[model samples]
Target: MSEKNRDGKRSARERLAAERAKQNRAEKRRRGLIVGAAVVGVLGLAAVIGVIAAGTGGDDGEASGPVVAPSGAQGEDSLAIPVGEESARSTLTIWEDFRCPACKSFEQAYSPVIHELTDAGQLKVEYHLATIIDGNMGGTGSANAANAAACAQDAGKFVPYHDVLFENQPAETDDAYAQDATLFELAGKVEGLDTQAFRECVEEGTHDGWVEKSNEAFRSGGFSGTPTVLLDGTNIYQDRSMTPAKLKQLVEEANQ
Candidate 1:
């Protein structure tokens, strides 16, 4: 072959190689973009699902049945404990696990009534945190969060923290209940909590004993599931569907 023809052929080969390399780089960039988009979509979907699950009540899945006060309850008035009448008649104690989804549902469902009652002095609700669901879902049960909540309670910030945790419950997965740095981060979002004190308590498991004792008493009282509500220490109702009307009815019936 002529020298000029050989040079032209070599140039053509080099140009082809360069073109192929450019195409390969473009393809790689496209693939990376696709993967990144998929990841973002999945994360966004997860956030949506978590929000819906947290907000929605799980009545169908709850272990407790429909709301029905015990028979022969002497009209709903029996349930009303007069507001601020604390002569052994003002307190309605509840034992619940933070990790228990049912407990979350119960809180969402009945918290309004409890709040109204508390505000009106018709009821004084004492919530005893339990950790019974910790081991059940392959995550840290309610113990860690409960302990932190108790610490917040000591700081007069329990209800706010409680609402935030319930509102931000992790999805039900292997790590759903794992207490970690994120929990402390969540606690920090609660207004008025001393972040340092809350973190210290969570790390040391300060309220572990309180949770333990509450669980022991709950078990002794025959509560196999979370969110067991008691009227004046008596096991009168055990339903996940304890709505405001039902709670009010029970309260009125009990007070009579």
Candidate 2:
């Protein structure tokens, strides 16, 4: 073959190789774009789902059940049922969920000492009702119980009814207090709390809105859980090792 012909063939082969390389690179770029676009789409979808789940913004699921907040409810102070004279020097503020076992335990252990102090006009307690259990467990037990307690309060039977409710608290999973019948039955245990006025309040859920208000107040106070006890604005639960006796001692110390 002639040298010119050989040179032309070599140039042609080189051109072909270059063209193939360019095509492969173009194909790689196209594939990269497709894969990157798919990844970005998935990430965006996941971000939306996360925002929805994290309670940032979502569809509002309103309940049709009758609810009414207590009149003049402002904060934890307003939600309290006073156990002693308004002029008492020391105050005990307790935030409790009716369905919470820990609250029942606290009540059982401390009721005697607390009652003694309150009856002596040495201390007053302001009870704050929260419904966190209902929010987590998907039931109306906490709300119903708190509402009924409020009715008992309306009838001037807050202390007795509150004690009895905790005494007969249903298991966390049982959620028996959601039933109006159960609440009425429990009311019967507290003398004078089973009246017609109390019945209407419980049946109509007159204080259901109050239950929600109390919970909101709890959250607004930057609290994350229940049975938060405060004495003279001091958190009593800061010491995990404290006992009922210690609590009483704290109250006594505050009184002085």
Candidate achieving the largest TM-score: 2
User: Cα miss at 140, model 1 (Å)?
Assistant: 2.2
Best by lDDT: 2
lDDT of 1 by residue, 92-171 (tens): 76767777777778778777887777766677666666666654554464756766776776666777788888877776
Any runs in candidate 2 off by more than 4 Å, and if so which? 1-77
Candidate 2 lDDT by residue in tens digits, 17-37: 999999999999999999999
Clashes of 2: 2
lDDT of 1 at 206: 66
Please report how far candidate 1 places residue 108 from its true position, in Å.
0.8
Worst 10 residues of 1 by lDDT: 70-79
